[model samples]
Target: MIPAQFDYVAPGTVADAVAALIDGGEDAKVLAGGQSLIPVLRLRLSYPSLLVDLRKIDELRGVREDGAELVIGAMTRHADVISDPLVRQHAALLAEAAATVADPAVRHRGTFGGSLAHADPAGDLPAVAVALGAQLVAEGPGGRRSIAAADFFQDYLQTALAPDEVLVEVRLPKLQGRWGVAYEKFSRTAQAWAIVGVAAAVRRDNGAIAEARIGLTNMGSTPVRAGAVEAALAGASAEAGTIAEAAAHAADGTHAPSDLSGGSDYREHLARVLTRRAVTTAAGL
Candidate 1:
């Protein structure tokens, strides 16, 4: 299937990209890696009048450290994210999750920001981002603004980014204490989207669980924070039994969707099961 014809522009800078998007109006679509959008275009799911390509913007393609956080450019490839020393050291959970995204070929072409901006609930990275409390940065005619990962994703396949705003980078705070992080996912196949996934980070103090963060994938319209489980684990024992008890609350707030892959109840069950495994591993129990 051939996509409908559209005007195209490769912007050298974010400013130019915003201008191009503004000029193209609501009919303009930003092209990052084109891993997601091109397929939509080919299937005629979207018919934009213009395509604003950001590949020419070199500044939006690297990882760097800024004080206490690691700043990842929006255009950084998944493969790069997985191998970047800075990402591996400061945000290993992100690298671990990136390793499970599709295969090597897609990893080389899929952009980090593009995946988050796509906001697929089943995507591994969004759940990691939410679990890490990462910040998403965007640029538009209104200048720049920072959005928390919790607020950045609004719904399935939807984000807080305005049509004219281009995601610039993501800021992940370096884990400061004795924190162990893990991502666990269940899919039909290696390349298939996760039916249920869990991202867990646990900080242990004196053999007790001081704090925990858990994010759910494919559990709701947006990546869901397991706040109930987090609260349950706070100041609790870092033992398998305690972690399993907290994991039981994984489905407490989720609105799991029923699809061809599995039913909502089945996903909820997977959530509890995977949460136990992920949290146990993260807790080093």
Candidate 2:
């Protein structure tokens, strides 16, 4: 389907982009890699009056270190995230999950910030971001501000970003200590959206699990932390039984969608099964 005609502007600077957004008002949509927006446009699900293209905004397009965190420019592509040495060493969960987003063609064009801003609950990166407690940086006509990953996503296809705001970068705190990470996904096909996915980060101390974080994908309206399971895994033995016990609560707080992919109960079942797999792998047991 052809999309409705829309005005397009490629801004050279963040400030210029903000100005364009403010001028375009409620009918403006920001374009990163156009991985999400383009599809919505083609389907006529969205009809923006103006498309503010940020491709020319060079500042928002790389990965760099800032003190104790890695600041990833929102425009950084999934392919770049997958291959970046810093990402692989410091935020391996993100790199691993990015590898599962669509295929090589889409990865080369999809942007990290765009994925987060698009706020698709099934998108692999959001679950990883929430699991790692990353932060999102947004720039708007008012000014710049930081939003925690937990708070950035509100609902399906919805985010906290104001109409005039543009996500500029993402800041992921280094996983201090010897943390093991894993992302487990269940899909019908290699590149299909996850029916249920789990992202796990386990920090081991001595012979016990010191800390564990779990993020659930496609189990709710947004990528949600498996808080009950996370709480349960703390101080628990790293044994398979113990991990399975904790993962049993993976669907406790989720409102899993019932769709052609699978029913709600089936997704909940996959959540527990995949969570156990992800946590066990992350715990290195």
Candidate 3:
């Protein structure tokens, strides 16, 4: 299917891009990696009057450490993230999740900030961002503003981004100490979107679970934090039984959809089983 006709503009500067977006008004869609948008355009889901491309913006294309936090540019490729030692060493959970996003080909083209801004609940990065407590940096006509991951996602296929805004970067808190992390994605096939996925970061102090951060994918209209499990396991012994006990509430407050992959009950069950696996794996016992 061919897309509706639209003008394309590749801006070399963030300010220029933002101005273009503001000028283009509600009819402009920013293009980063184009993995998601191109398909949407091809299928005519979105018919923006103009497409703003950010690929050539040098400042928006790398992974780096800023003291205790890691900042990833909006155009940073997933493949680059999978290989960056800075990301691999300090925030390994992100790298692990990136490896599971689609296959090698898609990873080579997908961008971290792009995926997050797209706000697809089934996409791995959104859940990972929530699990890691990352902040999204969006730039608009006024200037840059930071948004917490919890506040960034609004609802089904929607985000808090304004029409004139473009996500410039993502900031992740550095993982230190005895943090054990894992991303368990439950999809029917390789490169398939997760029917229900979990990204967990668990820190152990002595034999007890010190703290845990868990994020749920495809369990609701947006990626959700597993606050029930986090609150349940804190200070408890890091064991399968304790984790499993908390895991029972995996789908609490979620609005999972019934689709070709699974029904609502099936997703809820998958949420439970996979939450246990993810928590156990992240606890490393």
Better of 2 and 3 by TM-score: 2
Per-residue accuracy of model 3 over 1-285 as CA lDDT, tens digit each? 999999999999999999999989898999999898899999999899999999879999898889899999989999999999999888888998999998898888989999998999899999999989999999998999999999999987799999899899999999988998899899999889999999988999999999999999999989999898899989999877899999998888888889999999999999989889988998998
Q: Could you tally the backbone clashes for each prediction?
A: 0, 0, 0
Task: Give the Cα error of residue 247 in candidate 2, in Å.
Answer: 0.9
TM-score, structure 2 vs. true: 0.98
Say what the RMSD of model 2 is.
0.8
**Tens-digit per-residue lDDT, 79-120, candidate 1:** 999999999888989998999998999998999999999998
In model 2, pairs of residues that clash are none
TM-score for all models, in order of appearance: 0.98, 0.98, 0.98
Report model 1's TM-score to 2 decimal places.
0.98
lDDT of 2 at 114: 94
For model 2, residues 1-285, the per-residue Cα lDDT tens digits are 999999999999999999999999999999999988898999999999999999999999999999899999999999999999999989999998999999899999999999999988888999999999999999988889999999999999999999999999999999889899999999999989999999999999987899998999999999999999999999988898999899999999799999999999999999999999999999998
lDDT of each: 0.95, 0.94, 0.91
| Lowest summed lDDT window (length 10), candidate 1 | 29-38
TM-score of 3: 0.98
Best by lDDT: 1
